[model samples]
Target: MSVVLLALSASLLFLPGLVIGLAAGLRGWLLAAGAPVLTYGMTGVLGPLAPALGLRWSPWVLLGGTALFALALAVIRGRLAEPERVWTRSKHLVVAGSVTLAAGVGVGLLFFASKGFSAIPQFWDAIFHGNAVRFIADSGDSAPSGLNVIAQPAAQNYFYPNGYHLLVATVHQFGAGTVVQALNAMNALLIGVFALSMTALLRTLRVRAAIVAVAAVLCCAFTGFPYDLLTWGPLYPYATGVALLPAALALVVRALDAPRPALVAVTALALVGLTAIHPSVSIAAAVFGLGLLAQRWLTARRVPPGELLTLALLAAGALALGIAHVLGTLSAAGGPAYDWAVQRGVPEALGRLVFFTRSFDEPQWWLILPFVIGVLAFRRLLPLLWLLVASLGFGLLSVGAAAYEGPWVALLTAPWWNDEWRLAALYLLAVVPVTALGLVTVLDLVRRPLPRRIGLVAAALSVLLFGYLSNGLYHQRNGNRLAITFGGGPTVTELEQQAMNHLAGLVRPGEIVFNDAQDGSPWMWALTGVRPAFGHALAGTEGDGLGKERPLLRERFHAYDTDPEVRAAAKALGVRFVFIGQGFVTGSQKRAPGLVELDKVRSLRVVYQNPDAKIYQLTEPDGQRPADQPGKTPPGGPVVVSSSPVKPKPTSSTPS
Candidate 1:
C-alpha cells in the first residue's frame, strides 16, 4: 500500500508538472522545477473543491482527481505546438537525476534519524496534528466549520490551518500505512521537492551552473535550519509550507522577468499552495510578490495587467478561504497562549545571525566569516539580502525583549510568529539562499590562474567544514538512547501504548471518555476515534472563548460525579466511560481530588483494570443504568472490580 501510494503520489507530482512544463515551454532544469509547483497548485485547488463537490477528502479521491486533471492537461498539450526538446540532451537527464538522487539521500537519512515511520510523530504537536489529519480523513470534510470535532470549544476548527491535514489525510486514505507514516512519506517527497526548487530558483536568478550546484549543496546539506523543522516540529504543515516557498518564489521570479500569462497563473497557484500549509509563508509570499510586481512596474513604467490581475485574484481567494482562521486568531489576540521570555539582547540576537538552535549535532562556525564576506561581494542579490534582514528582525521580535515589547509586539507577532522556535523556520528560508549565494560568490573569486589551486583548496576546506556542520549522523546514531524525550523523542512507552490500545478496544467510537486532561487524553481521537474530556491546557483545545466545551472539560477534571454540573456536562458531552492512570498525569494532575471522590460515587462501576490504567463505566445519575449490567450495588460505595485483560461488548447507539 505504501509503494502504491508512493508511485501514485509521484505521478500526481510529476505528471501535472510535466504537462505544465510542456505547456509553458520550460527547458532543461526549469522543466524539472516547474513540476512541484504544478503538483502543489493542483492539490491546493483540490482541497477546497473536494468538499464542495460532495467528494470524500481521502488520498484515493485526491489521487483520482489529480490523475484525471493530469490526463486532461496531457490532452490539451497534444493540441498545442510541437513540444520543445525537454531533455535537450542526455546531460540534462543526468543533472536532473543526480540532483534528485542527492535529495533522496538527504530525505532517507532524515527518515532513519527520526526512527522508522509510525502512526504518530513523537512531537508534542503531533497530539493535535495527527488527530486533525484523522478527523479530516475520516469525516471526508475539510471545511472550516467541520473541524474541531475532537476537542472542546469547537471554534478552534476555524483557527488551525487545514492545508497540511488535507494533504496528509488525502494521502493516508490512498496509502497502505498509518496516518503518521503517510505524513512521513509526504515530508520526504516535499523535502526533495524543496531541494529541486532551490536549484531552480538559483537557475532562474541566472546563477552559473557550477555556482547553482554549489548553492544546491549548501541548501540540502544544512541539517540545522530546514531539517531542524522536521525534528523540532516535527512541524508537518509549516515544514511543507516552507518547502514550497522556494518553488513558488522561483516561479514568481520567472514571471517578473517575462510576465507571461501562464507564468502568472503558475505563480498565483503556487502561492495558494503555500497559503494552505502555512499562512506566515503566504504572508511572506504576498510581500515578495507585491515588491517584485512593483519593481517590474517601476522599471517598465507600466503595470503588467495580466500579472497584476493574477496576483489580485490569488490575494482575494486566499483571504476569502482563510477568513475564518484569521478572524479566529484576531478574536483571541490578547497575547500569546504561553509565556515566551526574552532569551537574549541585541548582542545575542546578532550572534544568532549565523548560529542555529536545535542542530546541537552540527555547528557551522567555519562558514560565518565567508558568509559575511560573500554578502558584501554579492550586492546584486538584493532581494535575498532584504529577506534575510526581515526574517532576522522577526526572529528578534519573537524573543519578547523588554525594549521590543509594546503594542507592536502583539500586533506583529500574534498567533503564528509569537514563538521564537517557529520563527526559526522563516530564518532558514532567508539564510539558506544568502549563505549559498555568498559561498558561491566567494568560490568565483579564485577562478583566476595563479589562485586556482588556492581556490580549489578553499572550496575543499569549505565543503569539509560545511559537511561537518550539516551532518546528522551523530543524531541518527543516538536516536533511541533517550528514555523519554521531546521534539520527536519517545513520548509513549510500550506499557502506555498497550494501555491506550486496551482502552480503545473497550470504548466505542464517537463515545466520550472522561480521562485526565494532561495525559493520553489528547491523543484518544487520533488513536481510536474516541473523544477525551481534555488534554493539556497550554496545548489549547479547551478552556477558551471558543465554545461551551471548555467548561465541560473543566467539570470533567474537577467536578465530583454526584455534582449535577458534572452529570449535566457529561450527559451533554455524551461521555460513557472514564479512563484513569498515570498516563493522565503530567507535570501535575489538578483533578486528583475529584478522581478520589469519583471512586466513592455509587453510580460508577469499574469495568476494566490493569496495573498502569483503569476504565470505569458511568451509570445514569437518574438510576437508569445500562441494560447489559446487573444492578448489584445500590447508592453506596461504587462496585470496584479488578480483572485481567478483558473486552466489553458494544452498548446502545451513541451520537458521534
Candidate 2:
C-alpha cells in the first residue's frame, strides 16, 4: 500500500517527461515542461548544501522558480514557429531508437543474467542510504553513535550520494512511498519524450530519424553497450539525473532549432538540473557550454543573449543550491567533518582523478561513418554535431579521472553511475541526428540498383559491429556472478543479509540505524532503515577519510549517520548493535596502523559469523558506546536528543 501510494505520487515527476513528449507536438510547451526536470535532477547533486539556499524543501520556491521559468520559456516559444514535424517515413530511426533502448535494458538484464542481482537483497541501499543519508547530514543531525557509521568499524568513508534515494525522495514529495515504480514510470515517460524530441528535431529527416536515435539512446540510456558494461558501486545522482537529462538536452536541441525563449528557458532548467545532480553534470554543463560558445563565436557570431543568460541563470541556481549545502555543514555547531575530493597534495589528488577515464564510452564505433555522411549531406546537422562534439569533449574532461572509493565510482561517474548515466545519455541523444543524416542519404542511394555487394557489405559490417558490442555485454553479465562463503563457510552475501535483517528485526518501527561504510556502500544501511555515517557523496567533510581532520571530525560522521543525538537519526533513533562485515568492507588505507590488528575482532561477540562476515552485538549499546570509536562524539553530552523526530517517509525518492 505504501509503495502504491508512493508510486502514484512519483507520477508528479514522471508526468513532466510524458507531457514534454506529447508537447513536442505543441512546440510552445516542449521546453517549459522539460526544463524543470533537468533542473531538479542537477539540483539533486547538491548534497548537504541545499538548505542554506532557502530552497531545499520549499515547494513554493520550486513552484515559483518553475512558474517564472515557464513564463520565460512561454514568451519565447510563442514567438517561434514550430518545426515541420510532419513525421518522416524513415524506418532507420525506428530501428535505431529501438535498438538503443533495447541495448540499455538488455545490457542491464545481461548484467542481471550474469550476476543475478545479488540474490542477497540489496534492498533500499540503492536509494535510502543514497539520498536520505544526505537529508540527515544536511539537516545537521549527523552523528556516529547511531547507524551504519558507528557499526561498521575500520573502513573507507565513502558516504556516497544517494541519487536513487533522492529520486525516490523527490517522487515521494508528490507520490509518497512506492518510489521504485515511480522511478521506472518516470524513466519510461522520459524515453517517450526523448523519442518525440528526436522526431521533432529532425522533422526534416522525420520519424525514421526519431526512431533510430531514441531507440539507440534508450538502449544506452540506463545501460552501456554490450561490449563495455559499467561496474557500479553506490547510488549515483548523475545516473538517475540522466533520466531527466535526455529531455533536457532535447530542449536544448529544440532551442537551437527554433531559438525560442521557452526552449532556452527549458534548456536553462536542464542546465540547472544537471548542476544539481552531480559535480560531473555541473562541470560538464559549464565545459560543454564553453565549447559551444567558442564554436558559435568562431562560426556564427550572432548568438542571442537570452540563450546565454538562461544558461548562466541555471548554473547560478545550481551553484546557489550547492553552496547552500556546503555552508550548512560548515556552520553546524558540532558540524560534520570534511572528506577530501580536494587535496593538500596535488599529486595524490591527481591520482584520484585518474579513474574518470572509465566514463569515456564514445558513440557507437560506427558513428564515424554516419557522421561523415551527415556532415556532407545535411548542412543543418552541423549545429547538432558540434553540440555532440562539445558534450563529448567536456564529458571526457569532466569524467576527468578519479579513483573509485567505496562501492560507488567517484571518477567520471560520481554517484549513481549505475542506475542513471546522465552524461552518456545526453551525449548519445546529440549524436543521433548526425547518424540519421548519414543513413537517410545512404538509403536514398542504396535504393537504386547500385551494386548489391555494397549494401550487403554495409549490412554485414553494421551487424558485426552491433553484435560485437552486444555479445560482450551479454557475457559480462555472466562474470558478475561470484560466490563466496563467510568464515570459510557461510555465504558472504547471505550472512550480510542475515546480519542486516537481524539488526532490522531488533529495531522498533520508527527507529533509525546508522553505519560507517562511508556513504556509497549503502548495503548495510539500505536493508535496515538506517542513516549512513557519512553525508551524501561524502559531502560536508573538511579533510580526507570522512573529513575527520576538521575539529571533532569524528562527531560529524556520527551525525551524518543520524547519530542517536539527532532526534530522527535511526529507525527508533537507537541502534542496538553494529554489524561489521569482513566481506562488505576491506578497511581504509588511511586508518591508524594498528587499527585492524587490535582485538577489535576478538572483542565483539558474533551474532552471526561466517567466513565472509560477522554480525556483532556491540559490547556496549548506544548510550554506553565508547567515545574513542571513530564516529563517537566527545563526552560533552548525550549521544541523542530527548525525543526523536519522525523518520522521513519510506517512499521518498532522493537522488539514490
Candidate 3:
C-alpha cells in the first residue's frame, strides 16, 4: 500500500506542468517530456512566493497557480486550437514503448537498489535533506530564503535551493508515506524523468525511431549517472536538475528552430526551473545550448535575425548570471569553494572518462565499440560529435584537477564545486544518444545481409544480448552500493531505528531529545516526530547559532547533576531526554563526551533501553521523576538505571 501511494505521489509532479504545457501550444513528445520541467519551475517560484503571499506551501498551491498561469497563457495566445496530429499510430507506439522500457529500467534499478521504500540513505547529506523535509512540513515554510532554519532556528535570509524539498514535502503531505519513503519515490521519479527527457531530445534531433528507442534504454546503462549520484553524495537536488536538463535543452532547440514568442517564453521558464533546482546543472545546460548555437551559425547558409538575437541574449544572460554567482551576490549564503583532492592520475582519469566511469568504479568497456562506430559511420552529425567531445574533455579536466589546476580549469569547474562526479554525469548524458546511434549503426550493418523478418529477430536478439552483457544495466554493483548506503552502519541500524520508534512514544510534544548528531539522531524528527536538539552533525559546531550551549551539552551533559551550566542549557533548550545510539556515523566506537557513561548520571533515569540504543529522561534535582512524563516505563515495572552502560557491537563499513 505504501509503495502504491509513493508511486502515485511521484506521478503528481507531472500534472501541473502538463496542463501548462498544453496551454502553451506544446505538442507530442515536447508536451510529454517538458511537463516535469515546468512542474519544477512552479515549485521554484511557488516555494518562496507562498510565504510572501500569506499562503501555506502545499501541492494545492502548485496546482492552483498552474491553472492560473495556463489560463493566462491561453488568454494571451487568443484561443486553444484543436490538437495537431503530430505522429502516426506506429510512431506513437514506438515512442510509448521506448519511454516505458527506459522508465522500467530506471525505476527497477532504484526500487531494488534502495532496499525498500522506507529505508533512509545513510550518507552525510541525507541527514540534512531528511531533516529539511521535516522542517518544511512542520514549519509550513518551504522558501529557500529561510530553509537554513532547519540547522539554525535564528537564521535570516539564507539560501539553498528548496525546489527538491518542496516536491518531497508535497509527497509527504499527500500521505504517500514517511519522509524517507517520499525521498526514495522522488529519486525513482527523477530517474524516469531523465529517461523520458533524453528520449525527447533524441527525437528532437531527428534521430531514427530505432535509435531513439535504444538510446532511451542506454540512458540507464551508464554507471556514472543516475546510480553513482545516488550512492556518493546521494546528491538528490543535483540529480533532479540534471534529470530536467535534457528537456530544457530540447526546448531551447525548439525555440531556436522556429523562433516563436511562446516557445521562447516556455524555454526561459524551463531554464528558470533548471537553475532553481541546481545552478551547476543550469551552467551545464547553458554550455550545451551555446555549443548548439555555435554549430547552427557555422552550418546554416542563412540564419534568421530573430534566432541570432535570441542566441546573443541567451549568451549575455548566462554571462551575467555566472558573474553574479561567482561574486557571491546571488544569495546570502555564498557559494562554497569545494576542493576535492584528485583521486586518480591523468592517464587513469582519461581512461575512466573514455569508459564513462566516475572514480574507481568498474569501467563499461562495451560502450567504446558503439561510440567509435557512431563517430565513424555518422561523421556528418558534427554537433553530436562536438557535444560528445566537449563532455569528455570537460570530464577529463575535472577528474584530473590535481594534475592541471590552470586558471581555465578553475573558472570552468568552480560552479560545480570542482567535483568530478557532477561533470562525469554530464558526460554520461551526452554518451547516451551517441552510443544508441552506434548500436543502431551496428544493427544496420547486420541487417543489410538478411531478410526483413529474420533481420528484425536478429536485432531484437542483439539488444537482449547487449543488456545481458551489461549485467542488466549494471544492477549488481549499483544494488550493492545502494544497500550499503541505506543499510545498517554506525549511522543507523534496524535495532536503533526500532529504539527511535519506541522513544517517540515516551516523549511529549514540544520537548527536544538531546543526542549525538553523528549517531543519526538528526533523522529523529523525520522518522519519529521527535525533535533532536542538534539537527545535523556539524550544526552546533559550524556556526548554527547553538553556540556555547551545544558545545557545553556535548561535553558535559552526563555531568548534569554536578554541572550547573549543563543542567541550565538542557533546561533552556527544553531537552527532556538523552538518546545514545550504537556508534558514530563513521562507524567508530568512540562516544560523544556528554553521552558516554550515562548510566552513572544520577540526574537521569532510563526510560527506554534496547541492544542498539538507550533513552534517558531528565530527572529532578532530588532524583525524582519529572512531572510531565508520568508513568512511562518498561514492560514490567518502574524504570531502573543500570549500573553499567550497554555496548553493542559496531559495524565496520562507513557511508560513502
Candidate 4:
C-alpha cells in the first residue's frame, strides 16, 4: 500500500500538473485567468479522491507519467504560442541573465533551508502530532485535509494541508511515509524551478529590477525579513504558496498589462494556480488581481465594466470554494468546528499580538530596520502596509495569545505570532511582502555605498541567526550520530542510537508511545515499520478559525488530565502497551491514584527503558487487545489510510 501511495503521489503531482499545463494551451484563456481558482478547486476535488485512487505507482510511474504529460504538452504546443518576452536593451541582457542566475541559486538555498536547514525538525507537526500517519492509518487511505473555502468544513475536517506529504506519498507508492532526504531534494528542486519562473518574470522588469531581484531572492533565502522567520521546521504549504504566488502574480501582470487573450488566459491560469497553492495565497492573488484592476482603473480615464466583472467573478469563485470547504467540515467526522468565539470580546483580541511565543518565534531582528525604511519609503504601499497595520491591530485587540481569541481576526488578516518559539507553522504572511519590500528597498540603495548596505547586511545577519536556529533543529534531527547522550548530546530528533534501540526492545507491533515536549519523532523514524497506538496531538489548528472541534479537544484533554481517565481510555481502546517519552510528563497514569510509573510497573513487565523512552506492558494481558483496535491487523483486509487524519475533536480531547 505504501508503495502504491508513492506511485500515486507522483502521478497526482507531476502527472496532473502536466495536464494542468496542457490545459493552459487549449483553455488558454480559462487556465491563465483561472489558474489559482482551478488549482484551488481541484485540490478540493482531488484531495478527497486521493485516498480512493488506492493505486500507488513507482519511479516507473514517475517515468511513465512524466512521459505521458510531456507528450500531452508537446501535442498542445501548436495550440499555445510563446508568451511575448519583454524586450530588453542590449546593455542590460548580460547583467539580467547573471542576476537571474544569482536569484535562482539564492532561492534554491531557501528551498534547501526548507529541507531541514534549521535546527527545527522538518515535517515537525506531521511527525509529532502524528496527523500524517494517524489519518493514513485511520482512514485506511490518505485523503485531502484542505478543500479550500468551498469544501464543507466537514470534508476538510480530517485533513490539514502538508505539501511534503503529498509529494512523499506519490513516490512512496506504499505510504512509505516521509523521507527527509527525498523531501529536501524535492523542495530544493521546487525552489529552483520556482526561482527560474521568477527570473523569467523579472526579465520583463527593468534591468535595474533584475539586480535588485537577486537581493529579493536573497531576502527570501537568508533574511528574517519574513519568509525566513519560521521555527516550526519547514513550512511546506506556506513556502509553496510563496513560490507559486510570484508565478501567479507574473501571469496576472502579463495578462493585465499585455491585454491579449493570451495574457488574459495566462492571468486566469495564474489565478487558478494561486488557488492550488493554498487558500490564503489564492486570496492574496485575488487581492493582487484587485490591485491590478485598481491600478488600471486609476490610470484609465474611466473604469471598464469588464474588469469589475472579472474581479467580482474571480472573488466570488474563490468565495464559493471557501464556503464549500467550511460546509464539508461541518458534515465530516473530525471536521474543524470554529464556531465558539464568534464575537470574541475586545479583551481577547488584544492577546494575539505577541509574535515570538510559540516554537518558531524569534525576535524580528533583521525585520525591524527594513520594515521601518519600507514604511518610510513606501507609505503608499497600502496593501503591504495594511498587512502590517492589521497585524498590529490584531495584536492590540487580542487579550493574550490564545488560539481561538483571534482566529476570526487572523482569518480576516494573516495570523502573526508575537512569540512563536515552539508551536505553529512558518506562514507566508510576513515573509512574502517583507521579501518584496527588502528587494525593492535594496534595489533603490544599490548604488549608495555605506549605510545602504546596512539593510542587506542586517538581512544577511538575520538569515544567519534564524537559519542557525532553524538549521540547528534540522541538523539535530537529521544528524548521523548514533546517540549523543543528554542535553548536550543528540537533541530533538537527533535521538541517540541507544535510546532508539532501547525503544525497539519494548515496542511490539501495535503499542501506544507517549513522549516528550516533541511527540512526532518516534512515529516518523521509530515507528516507520509499525503502527503506533497513541502519540502527541497538535493544539494549533486555529488556522481553520473559530473551530468547534478545538474546543472539544480542549475539553477532552481537561477531562483526561487525570491519569486514571486517560489510562482507562487507553486501556479500553486496547492500548495496553505504553512508551513514556522524555522532555514531557506524558504519563496519563500519573494522574491516577495508586498508579505506578511505567518505569516502576512491577505488575506489568518493563520491556524497554532508555534516556528517551520507557516501554511498559499492561498488568492484565486481556487489556492489551481489543475487538476493534486502531493499529492492530485483523484477519480481514489490510488497512487503508486517508490523508486527513480526523481533526482531533478540537475542544473535547475526545478520541476520534
Candidate 5:
C-alpha cells in the first residue's frame, strides 16, 4: 500500500510539465521526455513565488500555475490543434523498451540499495536534505532563500537550490508516506527521467533506434552517475539537475537545428529548470550548447540571420548567467568555492579516466573498447567528436589538473566546487551514448553475415554477455555500498529508532529536544513528531553566531546541574528533553562530553530507554520536581533514579 501511494505520488511529478509541454505543442517523445524538466522549472519558480503571493506551496498551485502559463503559451502560439504523429511504430517500441530497461535496472538497484523506502542515505548532505523536507512541510515555506531556517530559526536568508526538496515535500504533503519514502519515490522517478531524457537526446541526434535501446541499458551500467551521487554526497539536487541535462541539451539541439520560436521558448524553459535545480549543470549544458554552435558556425557555408541571432542570444544569456552564478551575484551567500586538495597525481588521475573509473570504484576497462570503436566508426561526425573531446577534457581538468590553481580553471569549475565526482558524472553523460553507439556498431557487424533469427539471438546474448562482464550493470557493488550506508550502526540502529518511536509518546508538542546530533539525534525530528533543537548534525557549529548560546548548549548541556549558564541556555532554548543515540555518525565520531555523560546530570530524568538510545526529560532547575513525575532529587545532587531502567544488550555490529 505504501509503495502504491508512493508510485501515485511520483507520477504527479510529470503532470504539470506534461500539460505545459502539450499546450506548447511538444509531441511524441519530446513531450514524454521534456515533462520532467518542465516540472522542475515549474516547482522551482512557484516554490519561491507562492509565499510572496500569500499562498502556500502545494500540488494544486503547481498544476494551476502550469495551466495558466500553458494557456498563455497556447494563446501566444495560437494553436491547440490535434497533435501530429511524429514517431513511427519503431520509435514507440524504442521508447517503451528503453523506459522499461532503464527503470527496471535503475529502480530495482535503488530499491535493494535503500533496503526499503523508509531508510535514509547515511551521508552528510542527506542530513540536510531530509531535514530540509521536514522544514518545508512544517513551516509551509518551500523557498530556498529561507531554507536556513531549518538549522537556525532566526536566519534571514540563505540560498540553496530547493527544487529537489520541493518535489519531495510535495509528495510528502500529499500524504504519500514519510519524507524518506517520498524521497525514495522521487529518486526512482528521476532515474526514469534520466533514461527518457537521454532517449530524447539520442533521437534528436538521429542515432539508430537500436543504439538508443542499447544506450538505455548502458545508462544504468555506469556507476559514476545517478548511483555514485546517490551514495557520495547523496547530492540529490545536483543529481536531479544532471538527470535533466540531456533533455535540455536535446532542446538546444532542436532549437539550433531549426530556430523555431516555440522550440527556442521550450529550450529556454529547460535551461531555467536546470538553473533552478542546480546551476552547475546548467553551466555544463551551456558548454555543450556552445560547442554545438561553434561546430555549426565553423561548418556552414552561409548561416541564416535568424539562426545566427538565436545562437548569439543563447550564448550571451548563458555567458551572463554563468558569470553571475560564479561571482555569487545571484545570491547573498555567493557562489560556492572549495579548495579540495589534489588526491592523485596527474598520471594516476589520467589513468583512472582511461579505465572509466572515478573516486574509488572498480575500473571498467571494457568501456574504452566501445568508445574507441564508436570514435573510429563515426570519426567524420564533428559534433560527436567535439562532445567526446570536450567532456574528456573537462574530466581530465577536474580530476587531474585541479592542482593548477589557475583563474580560468577556478572560474569554470567553481560552481561544482571543483569536485571530481561531479565532473566524472558529467563526463559519463557524453561518453555513455557514444559507447552505446559503438556497441551497436559491433552488433551490426556481427549481424550482417548471419540469418535474421540467429542474428537477433546473437545480439541478445551479446548484451547479456556485456551485462555479465560489467558485473551485472555494477549493481552488486553499488548495492553493497548503499546497503552498508543505510544499514544500522553507522548512523541509527533499529534499537535507536524504536527508542525514538517510544519518545514520540512522551515528548509533548511545542517542545524542543536537545540532541547529540553527532550521534544521529538530529534524525529524531525526522523519525518522530518531536522537534529537535538541532535539525542537522552540523547545525550547532556550522551556521552563524558561533561562540554563542547554541554552541555553548551543544558542548555543555549535560552540565546543567552544575552550570547556571547551561541551565539558562537550555531554558531559553526551551529544551525539555535530551536524546542520546548509540554513537556518532559514520566518519564523524567525536567524544562530546556534555552529550555523552547525560546520566550524571541530576536535572535530567530518563523518560525512555533502550539498549542503543535514551530520552531524558529536563527536570526543574530548582530542587522541586515536576508534578507529573514527583522525584526527590535536589539540585546539583547525584543522578535521580528513573522509572525506566537501562539494560545492556550485546551486539557485534560496527559502524562502516
Candidate 6:
C-alpha cells in the first residue's frame, strides 16, 4: 500500500517530463528519463514567479505550468509528431533490465531506510528541511526569499537550493498520509532518478546495454552516497540535487550534439534545474559541459557555432532571472558560520575520495579502483580524466585557507565544493560510468572461454566485496550489528512526540516558544507549528536591523523566571512560553550560569510536565508586569535598559 502511494506520487512528479518527452518525441525510457531535471528546473523558476503573481506553489500550479510549457512546445513545433527510435530486441531488453534493477534497489532501499520518517527526522538538518516543507505546505509560500522565517522574517536560504524541499512540500500537499511519508516517498523517487539518470546518460554516451544495467545497480550499491548520507546529517537536499544532475547533464550533451530549438530549450531548463536543485550540481555541470566541448573541439577540429550561440542565449536568460539570488549566495560565502578551522591535508582529501577514514560505513577503495583503471584504459575517456582533475582540484582547494581560498577561488567552489564530501557525489557521477566500462573491459578480456553469465556474476561479486570490505554491509542499530537494516539513525521517541502534541494544543499558531537546544527545538517546529526562539540555525538572529534584540531575548530567556527586565524583554519579543525538555541540562551548559538561574527562578508557573519534558507559561492576566521586588536585584543589580534599537547582522547560511 505504501509502495503504491509512493508510485503515484512519483508519477505526479514525472508529469512535467511526460509532457516534455511527448512534445520532444522521445520514446521508451528516454521519454520520462528527463523528468527529474525538467521538474527541478521548472520548480526553481516557478518559486520566484509564484509569489510575484500572488499564488502560492501547489500541485495544481505545477500542473498548469507544465500544461502551458507543453502548449508552448506544441505551438513551436506546429504538430505532435513522434520521432523514430530504432533499437534491437536485445537493446530493448537491456534498457528494461537496467530500469528494473534501478527501481528495485533504489526504491527498495529508500523504503526500508526511511520507515520511521513519518514521525520525525532522526538526523540534524531534518529539522530545517522538514519544517521548510511544512511551512510551504501550510502557507503555500515556496518563494526562495523569506525561507528562514523561523528565525528572521527577512532571512532566505539562497545559499541552499529549495528545489528538493519544494518538491517534498508538493508531495505532502497531495499525498494521502503524513509529511514524513511524503518525504520518504520523495526520497525513493529521487533514488530512482539517480539510478535511471545514470543509465539514461550511459545510453546517451552509447555504452552497451549490459554495462548500462550494471551501472544502474552500481548507482544504488555505493554506500558512500545515496545511502550513507541518508543517516549522516540526513543530507536529503544534496542527495536529491545530485540525483537530478546526471539527467540535466545528459540533456545538455544531447542538445549540444544535435541543435534543435526544442532540444536547446530543454537543455536550458535542465541547467536551470540543476542550479535550482543545488549550486554544486550547477558547478559540476559547467565543468562537464566545458570538458565535453574541449573533447569535441579536439576531435572534430571545429566549433559548432549554432550550438554555442544557443547555449549562450539560454545562459544569459537564466542568469538575468536568478542574478539576485546568485549574488546573495556569493556574498554569504566564507561567513563565520561556514568557516572550518580543521586543516585537511592532501592525504586526508584523498582519503575522502575513497571514503577511507571517513566513517565506519564509508566505501572501500575497490569500488573506485576499477573506475580509475577504466579511465586510464580508454583514450576516448581522456576528457573525463580532465573533468575528474577539475573536480578534485576544486575539492582539494576547498579544504584549506591558502592563497587559493581567495575570492577568485571561492567563485569556483562556493556552496558546492565548500566541503570535500559534497564533491564525492559529483565524483560518483563520473565514477559510475567509468566503473561500468571497466567491468565491461574485464569481461571482454575473458570472453573467449568464460560464459557471459559467469562474467555478470563476477561483476556482482566484486560490488558485494566492495561493500563488505568497506564495513558498510552492516550497520549498528540499538548497539547491535544488523544486516539488511532499512536505514541508519535513531527513531523519534514516542515520549517526545506526546509532549510535543500536548504543547502544540496549548500554544496558538505562530506563537514564540523558548526551547533549549539540547531538547531538539531546532527541528520540532515542523511538527508543532510553533516558532523556536533560538536553535543552531537561528544562532544570533543578529540581522534585519534588530541585532541587539537577539541578545536581549537570549538574556531574557535564561533569566525570565527571576529578572523583571528579562520578562520585559520577553514581552517585547513576543515570547509566551518556555519549554525545558529532558536533555536541557545534560550538555556542556549543565553548570552554566543561565541554567542555574533558570532552575532557581520562581515566577515561571509550570503549565505541563511529563517524564520527557516540561512547559512553563510566562504570561499573566491583563498583561501587566509583576511588581519589582526590593531584593530582586542580584549582586550586580538591575540591567541597564537602552533606548536605541541595535541593528543586527543577518544570520549566515553556511553549514556549521
Best by lDDT: 3
Model 5 residue pairs with clashes? none
Native-to-model Cα distance after best TM-score fit, residue 222 in candidate 5, in Å: 0.4
* Clash count of each predicted structure: 2, 139, 0, 154, 0, 7
In model 1, the runs with Cα more than 4 Å from the true position are 1-31, 67-98, 156-159, 231-234, 294-339, 358-363, 380-403, 441-491, 535-550, 556-560, 581-602, 609-612, 620-656
| Candidate 3 clash figure, as a count | 0
Better of 2 and 6 by TM-score: 6
Q: TM-scores, in order shown?
A: 0.79, 0.57, 0.89, 0.58, 0.88, 0.82
Write down the TM-score for model 3. 0.89
Model 3, range 1-656, lDDT digits (tens) per residue? 55685566657678778887888788778788999888877776677678879988777887888888788767655443334335667876876787787677666666776666667787667877888888787777866756564566545545677777887888888776889888887787766788789877876776677777777777766777777777767788898888788888887887677555455556666776776677777778878876777777778766669887876665454344233222322653353455565666787777777776553466776777887777677663555655676677667656656345656766677777667777778877767877877898888877768999998888888878977887876666656656666665557767777778878877778988898878877778888878888777662225545556777898888889888888889988888888887756664435778888988889887776766778887877667654545445532235433444344544645333
- Measured over all alpha carbons after superposition, the RMSD of each candidate to the real structure, in angstroms, is 6.7, 11.2, 4.1, 10.7, 4.3, 7.9
In model 6, the worst 10-residue window by lDDT is: 478-487
Instruction: State the C-alpha lDDT per candidate.
Output: 0.57, 0.39, 0.72, 0.39, 0.71, 0.60
Ranking by lDDT: 3, 5, 6, 1, 2, 4
Full candidate order by TM-score, most accurate first:
3, 5, 6, 1, 4, 2
What lDDT tens digits, residue by residue, belong to model 6 across residues 1-656? 58666866787678777786667545565556787778776787777678889998898888787788767666665433333246688877776776677666566555555553353545445666777787788899877654656445434343446777787788778756666677777776665777788776666666667677767766755655666555445677777777877677667667666656666666676677767766666777777777767877777788878767867866875675456445545655534434333445656656666553343444445556666667766564553554556655644553432223456545544555345556555666766767766766665665535678886676667556655764442222211211122222122344555556666776766566766544455455676666666533333323652334445655455666556677676666576677665432112223223434454456555656555555666534322235534345322123222233322222211122
- Per-residue alpha-carbon lDDT of candidate 5 for residues 1-656, written as tens digits (9 for 90 to 100): 45775576657778888887877777777788888888887776677678878887777878788888788767756543234335678767866787778777776767776766667666666777888887777767866765665565655545667777887877888786887777776786666788888888877776667777877777776767777787777788898888888888877777676565555565666676787788778778878777766776777766668787887766555444233232332664352356556667777777777676664456775677887887777752345655676687678666644445567766667767767777888888777878887888898888777899999898888878887887786777656655555655556667777777776776666877877667777777767757777776662335562226667887788778889899888878777778887756655467566786777777877766766777787876553455543554432234333344444422322222
Deviation in Å, model 4, residue 637 alpha carbon: 28
The lDDT of model 4 is 0.39
| Residue 448 alpha-carbon offset, candidate 6, angstroms | 3.1
Whichever of 1 and 6 has more lDDT, that candidate is 6
Model 1, position 157, has a per-residue lDDT of 33
Candidates 2 and 3 compared by lDDT, better number:
3
Provide the lDDT at 632 for model 5: 46
TM accuracy, model 4: 0.58
